[model samples]
Target: MAKGYKQMLAEADALVVSVTAEEMAGKLEDDSIVLVDIRDPRELEREGMIPGARHAPRGMLEFWIDPESPYHKPWFAEDKIYVFYCASGWRSLLATRVAQEMGLDAQNLRGGFSGWKKDGHPTAVKEKRRT
Candidate 1:
């Protein structure tokens, strides 16, 4: 039998710390916490994102986090707590585990963007970056 997504998610969840929307809400203004949105661009456009969250598409996350990769994002090298989220937490959970393995202090946003919105937390429209 092959390992499935459920099993993968379970393993990741066990290793990665999860923060509730309410908990993350309180840290919105904390400079040390970096909120990373790991959802796809289409998803974000269809459904706004948490205010102050940086968009880092899930497909390129590993490359972006690798310092040796040309795609590496400078912010990932910063000494900050990374809180990752997706539409419903699944993607972010796996992403967080990988990030932690890469040596960053990463965490998952419990229930992801859905939970945040359900909890009445504020969201902001993502602006298109100018070429």
Candidate 2:
């Protein structure tokens, strides 16, 4: 944690808010949390995705979260919980930051997509050959 950021995290009621892939896997059947894939379409096409996770593309996440915006979807509401993941933890961290910034209850999967697979969760493989 960065010096000032750490202090802010403690002062702002913010928590570490992280969960491993295995924990998330067991929670998937629960309706209380929404799993989002923040990876680009190309990545999903190449590596497939987590079953039941929604694709919100990292690029347009904010747009989708804007309640009054034409792109707004039911998933953007702050009352809804979110678990975001990407090929690695970086993008998912960014996504979680965005969701938190928007006042949504969200957390990042520490190891992300790779971690999900490593934890023995079933992955949805797209029917295509990787180049």
Candidate 3:
């Protein structure tokens, strides 16, 4: 039987660092941290993202993270703490686990963008993606 979403989230949460919005806010001041937004384009358009976060759609995460892949983004090669977030924490937890497995230093923002907003962190409007 396939594992349920909650089980997967629990497993991922255990393996990946889950930081609170306040913690993430402090980390933003560090030059060695990269904030990655993994939410869909539509979601971003509807709700914005953490200021200065890189937009890496969830579907392309693996390709973008692999150095050997043609789709790899140069930013990923930099030695920085990758901090991923989505509309909520669920997607980020899983993504962080996957990135960790790929040998990347990664962590997820606890409660994701929603938590950020709830915690009163500033958000920036997302730029429209090129088609």
Candidate 4:
């Protein structure tokens, strides 16, 4: 029997959750959340992070998010409230949805990093090396 393309695509997108950065900020301020930055190292190396956000990287998100995986400890704690983010927020949205599917209380940062920048939040610039 042949598989349906739509069914495959839908399955591909089945696990992801989403939220806005503004909503995240409010939650963070109240000490109610944990920020997970799932962007690649190159992007973060170029643009820096949102101060206290943990680096998980999209490539290994599923692995790291899994309690059975060794990479889980650094990112997960008991009852952790994770909020993943990316450059444009789409990635984070997809990620959070996946987390939700995985039975985790996760959300995505709206507008991703850009939302934070637009809100007058601080961002660190990678200093050019003068060799």
TM-score of each: 0.96, 0.80, 0.95, 0.74
Off by over 4 Å in 4: 1-18, 124-131
Q: Model 1, which residues run further than 4 Å from truth?
A: 128-131
lDDT of candidate 1 over 15-115, digit per residue (tens): 99999999999999999999999998878887899999999999999999999999999999999999999989999999999999999999999999999
C-alpha RMSD (angstroms) for model 1: 1.4
Best by TM-score: 1
- The candidate, 2 or 4, that scores higher on lDDT is 2
* Ranking of all candidate structures by their TM-score, best first: 1, 3, 2, 4
lDDT of 2 by residue, 79-109 (tens): 7679888986777776687778887888888
Question: 1 or 2, which is superior by TM-score?
Answer: 1
In model 3, the runs with Cα more than 4 Å from the true position are none
Clashing pairs in 2: none
Candidate 4 clash pair list: 15-97, 15-98, 16-96, 16-97, 16-98, 17-96, 17-97, 20-110, 21-110
Give the range where candidate 3 is weakest over 10 consecutive residues by summed lDDT.
22-31
- Evaluated at residue 98, the lDDT of candidate 4 is 73
Q: Which model is ahead, 2 or 3, in terms of lDDT?
A: 3
Better of 3 and 4 by TM-score: 3
- Model 2 TM-score relative to the real fold: 0.80
